[model samples]
Target chain A: MEQHLVDCDLCFDALQVLQQQQYREKYQPLSASMQQYIRNSIKQVSHAHKAERYQRQEQKKESFLIYFWVVAAIAAGAGLIYLIQQQDKFKPSVTKAMASNAEIPAQRVEAPAVQAAVVTPVRAERADTLSHRPAPPAATTTAPVAPPAATPAPATPKPVIKDSVKAKTPAAVPVNKDSAKKQAPPATKPAEVKETVKAPAPEHKDTPTVAKKTEDKPEPKPVPKEKKDDDDDKPKPKPATETAASGTDEFLYKAAMVYHQQGDLNEAISRYKHLSGSSGKYGELSRYQLAVCYRSKGQTGKARRMFKEVVRMNGSMKDKAQAALDNL
Target chain B: MLQQLSNLSDKELISRARKLKDQEAEGVLMERYSHLMVAVCLPYLNNGPATSPEEIYPALLQRLSDSLKTQTIPKANEWIHYTIRAQQARTDKNSPFFPSTESREQQQIEARIEKAATNQKEQQQLIATIERTLDKLSAEEKYLLKEFYMNNKSFAALAETKQISIEKLRQTLQQAKQKMASLLMNETYE
Candidate 1:
């Protein structure tokens, strides 16, 4: 019928006549309603499929986020555990090394040793040297010039100048000539004693402290001057090595200072290095000046190390070294 | 989406409906055959308690829908006609729809004809094969086919010329076409 209808005008005309019949009107609306109903059913099925797909995608995303957080938490917990273990490993070394020096919590042997440890290495060494030195026979005589400290040989470490048992040199000397007359015979010391006393005064900034002492103790002049004479006589009574060590330390310090002033950093660094081992004022001073020279020469790493050493030395330049280190 | 689905052939729509469980493709296929179904069932409407147009059409649609899911339908017209006739007789038989070999052959030949429309050489080849197939048929079948196709005679006109009913004429024309398709396919396979 289709093959015939394609070439036949009569069949096409008959199809049009059949389409014009009332049966089309009867089924057309029904067919349209059926199509709409079917479309609605299809839309419902498609919507359900889309909802299922969306729900699956959301579940996958949620699971992925859960995995990510779990991994992150595991990494963080592992890192924290490592840090704690590292801290635990270091704790015993600290407690053992500081055991004798610092007081143990259970038995705090004494805190004076801890204080001695905490004190600057220079001041602590000075205190040890002073305490180890023999008590001069003129200690009681020098009481008027001495500070008010009364501690024994193994005393708790004080500051750099806790010399109550020793005499104040400048305080004992009269600054003007007239007051110098009344104390002449008693204050007269050997030329060697006087020269030894006066030889090391102008090295660094310690000379001003001497003048400050005289100004501070102008009233107790006569007794302290006798005490000063006793202190001068101490050099002659000392071992030869003591004076010789002091002389070398002073000479090395002066040579370093000369090179330092002349901008010869390499030579100065070498000289300072030599002097820095000797535990005295020059040792502390050389270390501090070495750090300063390093800073000037732009060897920042070496400079930082030297400054840290000075700060650890707890010398007069500790504050300056700490500030420079903080800036660096 | 409906416009694009409407553009698909009956075979494509059947494939989508069966494999993808696409209701819209099924709907397009049903709507494509709705007029034919209505025309076939028009005489049987209100003939019995179950034969109302509304009842018969819905029931026919339901049977076609159920069969569409499970059956391999090569020819939708034959499947829909079987479903409509089954509904009209109130047979209550649950037999699944299957395409006859003749229908499959006819469908194959129709597909080949459609494919060859673009290539003139292939189109001439197909035409020659069909003519050769036509010449090999019995005289009565061959005469019915030539009158219906080459003469462009309507089924009513041919039935009137033979002094037979239009239904018988249509049946004879159907048999002749099937014979031609079977002959063409048998030759192709050989």
Candidate 2:
């Protein structure tokens, strides 16, 4: 630049003028204001960029909040579904427990009917054979056979069972059946008579076969046996008729049948079970009806056992009990 | 703050303007060269509406300020001088200032000299390379370089000794300096 300045007269002249320090003063204030102008522009640009960045951050925050709410709602809905499903699991079990409670009491009542069906038929036969005894033969001529047979509690059902089993020859089974049919009261409802009319087959078969058995026995045993035979034949024909015609057990049984007809099976079962302990035409009938109550209550096992006991008694009800057992 | 800014080098001021976007640093840089701009522009002032002092000086400073962000300005004087001349011609308002190849080469050598200043071995090597390149120039360039740089003679005194117009002499000297800078730049690349 020092070498070039010698040849450039115009630049040399401009330099000489600037050496005076007068033109330097002229440009200074204009320079100051231009610098101020550029600084103002920088401030404006920086402020604008800062505002844009802040707006972007706020937009990001709002988007994140929206996502959070959507996830929260989905979680809450899932929780509600799970809660409902959990409750559904317990609901059916509660219903099943209530059903089981109802069935347990039903089973308890059926159990007693089953017991009475097993115990009472033999006792009723015992009571009928013993209660019809004439007072004198019951003491003397019939003492050998009647002493054991007439004992109230211990020996009575055994003798009655032995007599009933030994008495029903195949020949007499039909005869007793006919007697049971003839003896059903005309005043009774057909349903009660259906069981009662069938009641006397084993009773009649036992007496007639017993009389024949006494007649056929050895001479020494036959003498005492014929006395019992006379006592059983003479009074049993009349007293048995009297007992069958108007027995307390018969009326009680009619009441139980009414309850059975009314669809109050529990009451009917309790009544039948009560009469089931006595002996007469009605005792056998109550045992048969108790089995019907057990069947109605859906206690088929107990019903089957009760029917088997009635069949074991070999009564007129044996055919009906066998048919019921086959149905079960 | 302005006093502190005034004490910083031109490189620091340019960095503050471009990197830090410090408008005040830019203002200080423009102000530093304002007097030379006023002097250089004085001849063309009031020659036309486009050349008025009220219009040209501010427009010239603004043009330099705009170019400062994008341009590689190693030497502020050469860049500013080229721009002032470009603005004075008034042919293209939107045309940006660019440093010439010769100016860039000269700026590279200046940078190399500054880098080697603290290293005695590099400074000596640089001085030897400059001397060897000066020995390669034509007699007149060598003579003018010696007379102007060595003797510290003014441009007018050198033009008088050579018995030529100062304009032609200035052009020859400019070409000689350009040749030296290119040779130095090529030597560095090798």
Candidate 3:
């Protein structure tokens, strides 16, 4: 047989085949016990793999959700900041309107003696001619009072009134009315006292409306302050999730699925690049999907490369790889 | 074992292992090569009918698991053949096979397999020197030889698994046999 195998090519090949088959026939059957052992080992290994794969998928799913929530939280924070800034902008105008209404009563309280002096008849005729000329000065003084009337805080009330009094350089007489009422028995005049107390009602009406709004939606103060401090203490996490730029492999892999689902094929292809750099089970899947995407877009070269990658990186992907290769 | 092989496309066998998770596919793989285990155990049991293959199979299966753990053999075929020869020698020493040159040859075959022949040239030289010259082929060639030899697969099934035409598969295998004959020829010359 050896000599014959050496001399003739077909006979030699047949001889090797014949001997091998004889060996197989002699001892190929497994005993029941061996079969059980094999079955047990296989089951154990498969279960382990199934468990591990499930765990990996669960972890990936959890991470994906975490990333989504982080992005949502950042957007909500930005929106809230814009709202607060908008509210702050309008705050000064409302406060200014309240301040102006408050100042009107303080001016009214000081004019009682002047009104009493004008009530006498002989003196009133002489006073009427002088008062007519003085009316322009009085009108100018009232115009100067407008800005201080609108100022909100009483602590700054004196400075604003002083500036208004200065602007009406000739309205020094009404300021004297204020000082005189401050010094003398003007508060002692019964009718004037009643008028002075009543003037504060309109001023109070303007202030309470703004005070009610402040109470309704209390500002997020202490919480934002503590959060800001904690944010400072920790390294701020890359602004939570800024739409991670193009070309980052991890981000690209993650974003590829997102963009593909969004029907942005161009962007999906762009991100699939990161996925192709490494080849494994998931990587093979990525290539197969990418090829499908490319084929749908009529890009044969890229589709071919991706499909070929699946074949070259074959293991789990062998059938898919073969199919793609056959198609190509 | 069926699930594991089912998991792998014949193409997957060509790629480098990406992750150890691919080991899941090893189940059907063991089944595919389960008969080879008998070939391994048969040579070990000369006085076989009373001891029974059932009893011998558990120890052989344990050895298979141990072999996988050691990663000493890359392809299942090489490990199967080597284990058969090795186990036969151990059994012969303890149980008394032929009480002749059979024991010596089995020991020699085991030693030849164990000898480190790193490069293809050294390995081919060793195969020539060794009386049993089947050890020199590359991992893929070894697998084809076994599928053709131990499994008794049809040419079509072999071709399908190998992802080649049956004609091509036959030609490649014929070339492998020629190389084996050539190595055996070198043995006579040396």
Candidate 4:
């Protein structure tokens, strides 16, 4: 049989076919349950991919909302800082107007009759002071009024000198008439009258006598005493006039600022307009404030006009006025 | 629709599965390849009357599913073949029948027979001829073929059971194969 297989191709082929038949019988069909398991697994994998895609989209939407809120918070914080800086810019102008009002009583003494005569001259001087040396005049006036109690002490002797002046010139009598009315009861006391009559009467007659007494006094004491006398005798009437004018200007500016701060642009605009017309130290500042009020009120044309006038003046407010004009 | 899909080949079914996410296409692929996969896995199974298809089928499906995910249709078929070959090698290593020279010779013969048969009708005819020849053999010849070839028993152990020398057992197997070959030739002529 071995020799036949070696010699014949048909015998070899038949043996090979029989072996393949034995091997092919090993393959068996799968049961129904196994196929069902495979289908279920594929469905699970597909569902997982879809769920992951949905989660990714949700995360994207959430991140967008987070970024939007963060940006909105930053904008709100910036707006608050800008409002605070704007208020800070308005503060110094209000303070400057207040300081100028405080300096008024020392510079000018007001007698009602003299006030009508003195106000125009004081305004001219104040304008000149603002243009060249805004600080020095206020400093000079404040230095003299440093001791108000000392001023009254020095004023006691002035009526005596004025009484002698009345005796020398009948023209001086009407000027002392109000002083006499206030002093008549004191004048009836003989020792007080004698002391006053003795000290100042000779000084009035002889200029040398008054000069010797002023020189013999310690220098510092006499300087302020003379200043106090001058302030009491003549400048007293002018201070009242100065206070009335400066007080009104300060009040108007302060009220405008208050109204502006409170967002009442109309009332602030009216008060700032009145100050802008006045020839006072606050005129330039008030014009700038008026422009701000007009701008706030959305009256852009009026704001532009006021800012233009302030820019042309070459005043301390010119830079701010120019900035305002540029904004418009 | 399912009948049309079933008519398609494994490569065509895989393409439909990828393009349409068609469950039917995937089902058809599973059905078509399931028998081949089970045959590949059979040598790995423990020798018993009751072999668990449950354990083997899911593992086979899982490997095929993983291959489907990363591969295009053309490459997926190659991947399935490679995976089955690799699994067969691993199972072959631990098989009690490994190193059986007779089993190796039988496998070679089986490959040649399958190549020559070509179609189901010829293969079925060969199977019938083998069954007829196996029935005509002596009881001892049938027992030797069943134990050594089908059951993958070591020849030395088979020889020991038969109370024969190893040389005599080889002579008996050679004579049984020549008898089967002669019977097949006679049937072909008839």
Ten-residue region with minimum lDDT total, candidate 3 chain A: A231-240
Which parts of model 4 have CA positions greater than 4 angstroms off?
A1-28, A31-34, A45-60, A63-118, A121-328, B1-39, B42-51, B60-79, B91-190
The per-prediction tally of clashing pairs is: 0, 5, 8, 12
> What is the docking quality class of candidate 2?
incorrect
TM-score leaderboard ranking: 1, 2, 3, 4
**Full candidate order by lDDT, most accurate first:** 2, 1, 4, 3
The docking category that best describes candidate 1 is: incorrect
Which tens-of-lDDT digit does each residue in B56-136 have in candidate 2?
A: 866887798889999887767767777877787776856766667877787788789999999999999999999999999
Candidate 3, residue A6: CA error in Å?
A: 13
lDDT of 1 by residue, B1-190 (tens): 6778899999999999999778878888887876556555555667778776657777778888999998877767667766766666677778777777887887798899999999999999998888898889989888988998888888778888899976567667777888888899999999
Which scores greater on lDDT, model 1 or model 2?
2
Question: What is the C-alpha lDDT profile of model 3 across A61-88, one tens digit per residue?
Answer: 9999999999999999999999999766
Model 1: lDDT of residue A6 = 37
Output the number of the TM-score-best candidate.
Answer: 1
Identify the runs in model 1 with alpha carbons over 4 angstroms from their true place. A1-29, A46-328, B116-125
For candidate 3, list the clashing residue pairs, or say none: A100-A149, A100-A150, A314-B12, A315-B12, B1-B27, B1-B28, B2-B28, B4-B25
Candidate 4 residue lDDT tens string, A187-236: 32322433243233222223322333322234533442355343233334
Candidate 2 colliding pairs: A6-B155, A6-B156, A7-B166, A7-B167, A124-A279
lDDT of each: 0.63, 0.65, 0.50, 0.57
Q: Which one wins by TM-score: 2 or 3?
A: 2
Q: Mind giving the per-residue lDDT tens digits that candidate 2 earns over A141-170? A: 445656666657446544544554455323
For candidate 1, the per-residue lDDT at A145 reads: 41
